[model samples]
Target chain A: QQQVKQSPQSLIVQKGGISIINCAYENTAFDYFPWYQQFPGKGPALLIAIRPDVSEKKEGRFTISFNKSAKQFSLHIMDSQPGDSATYFCAARGAFGNEKLTFGTGTRLTIIP
Target chain B: DAGITQSPRHKVTETGTPVTLRCHQTENHRYMYWYRQDPGHGLRLIHYSYGVKDTDKGEVSDGYSVSRSKTEDFLLTLESATSSQTSVYFCAISRTSGGQETQYFGPGTRLLVL
Candidate 1:
């Protein structure tokens, strides 16, 4: 019954290295994919998002590569930094006013200096 | 971040007691929501309101109720608190524009039930 599945519950990467987190969803009806970043004691914030129309979207050093056919998407942090360390969650929403979001379990990202 | 504020940022209550969490916004947006965050589970929507007096349940609406009498306020009530209800709650707002607009979240309210 879990709609979205995320991998590597915890990850560690060098400051200048790349960090990747992956998520897969079973519901094919989901049309929108968004990633959220949450810090300790704070609410989750929107980091990046993608639609089924595009294969990739990049903003600054963050990139979301989406594969609609596979129902999979991955977040890539280019030149990861300590500030990028936090919990990341992948969410999906169906079309129309079905505005409800189904979120993944979550992944804890850590950047080691 | 969208001028959203949640009152009683932290609370600890006894089981069988009633609790209410308030979300106030200055954005005048059309959509508001209540969600709970727990370890590993990320966040799940409990209820949402699209307009004054127009509301609907979300994925996890059991054991909770919500109301919106005005555009600026949304209230979430736990008729009877339970230990399993311990988690951080968040309020968010979004505009029904081109698409499902991005949501802006509040600082969050932490609640504990004993």
Candidate 2:
């Protein structure tokens, strides 16, 4: 079973527009929610992450809005640029020393200029 | 950027053959993980190690094995290559088991089984 589910397998947004991706989780034990960005032929890099205690966290133009009550979270990129085109993955990790991460299928984001 | 490097970045082998991929890190992290990435599957963990000579299986560990002899090296071995095992493998390192610590990933090693 996929503990974390992501929506919109692929997305396209115009430059300077906002890009959003959503993810939902079934396991309440998860406390850490992180998003990773992967470029072609490279490894996934940490983008932004939020803990259950915080409802939102922002890093530069990337923001993560998390709703613990709803068991859902979303990533918002302000003023999306062509350089933002890449694959994004949402992951959840349990608090009980479970180093393993449960990842969403993935979302291929494209910013059209 | 995390000082992680993967060896044999690309490998092509035949079925029934054995293959091994290596991951080296200079960050001296405590946790190391091996994950595979496919088209439909985002990234599935095959195995992980928390310390030297300690290892555990992950979500997908059927045909794979791993070893960590030192803090800087983690190796993933395929007992016998299979067509279904063809995928891109990645290695990740983290300073701690859980919390706000983020895992840093290596470039990746692409393997093909014929």
Candidate 3:
């Protein structure tokens, strides 16, 4: 079973426009939610992360809005740019410190200039 | 970039043949993981190692095996390669600090099975 599910397999937005990607999880044991960005031929890199304790966390132009009650989270890019175009993945880590991460299907974001 | 490197960045092998991918890290993190990325499936963990000679399976551990003989090296081996095993593999390392753990990934290794 897919513990985490992501929507909009692909997305396109104009430069400077807002870009949003959403994800949902089924496991309540998940405590840490993190977003990763990946370019062609590269591994996914950590973008932004949020804990269930916070409703939202913002870093630069990247923001993570988490709704623990709904078991959902989303990533928002305030000023989408061509360089920001890439694949984004949402992941959930269990409460156990040694547990492995559970990742979402992934979303391919494209920012057209 | 995390001081992590995957060997044979690209490889093409035939079905039933054995294949091995190596992950080397310089950070000395206690936790290491192996994951495969597929379209629409995102990244799925195959196996992980918590310390030398201590390993465990993940969500997708079938047809694969892993070993960690040292703190800096983790190895994933395919006893018999299959077309379905063709995917990009990534290695990640993490250390728990202050009740928080963050995973850092390697570039990746692309493998093909014919």
Listed models, DockQ each? 0.68, 0.70, 0.82
Ranking by DockQ: 3, 2, 1
Q: Whole-model Cα lDDT per candidate?
A: 0.91, 0.93, 0.93
Q: Is the docking of candidate 1 incorrect, acceptable, medium or high quality?
A: medium
The residue-by-residue lDDT of candidate 3 on B1-114, one tens digit each, is 579999989999999999999999998888999999999899999999999999999989999999999999999999999999999999999865435787888999999999
lDDT of 2 at B114: 100
A1-113, model 2: which lDDT tens digit per residue? 88999988999999999999999999999988989999999999988888899999999999999999999999999999999999999999987444688999999999999
In the range A1-113, model 1's lDDT, one tens digit per residue, is: 78999988999999999999999999999988889999988888889888889999999999999998899999999999999999999989887554778889899999999
lDDT of 1 by residue, B1-114 (tens): 788999889999999999999999998988999999998878889999999999999888999999999999999999999998999999999754346577778999999999
Give the poorly placed runs of model 3, Cα more than 4 Å off: B96-99
Q: What share of the true interface contacts does candidate 1 keep?
A: 0.68
User: What is the alpha-carbon lDDT for the whole of candidate 2?
Assistant: 0.93
Backbone clashes in model 1, listed as residue pairs: none
Give the poorly placed runs of model 2, Cα more than 4 Å off. A96-98, B96-99
Instruction: Order the candidates by lDDT, highest first.
Output: 3, 2, 1
Stretches of candidate 1 off by over 4 Å are: B96-100
- Root-mean-square deviation of every model: 1.5, 1.6, 1.2
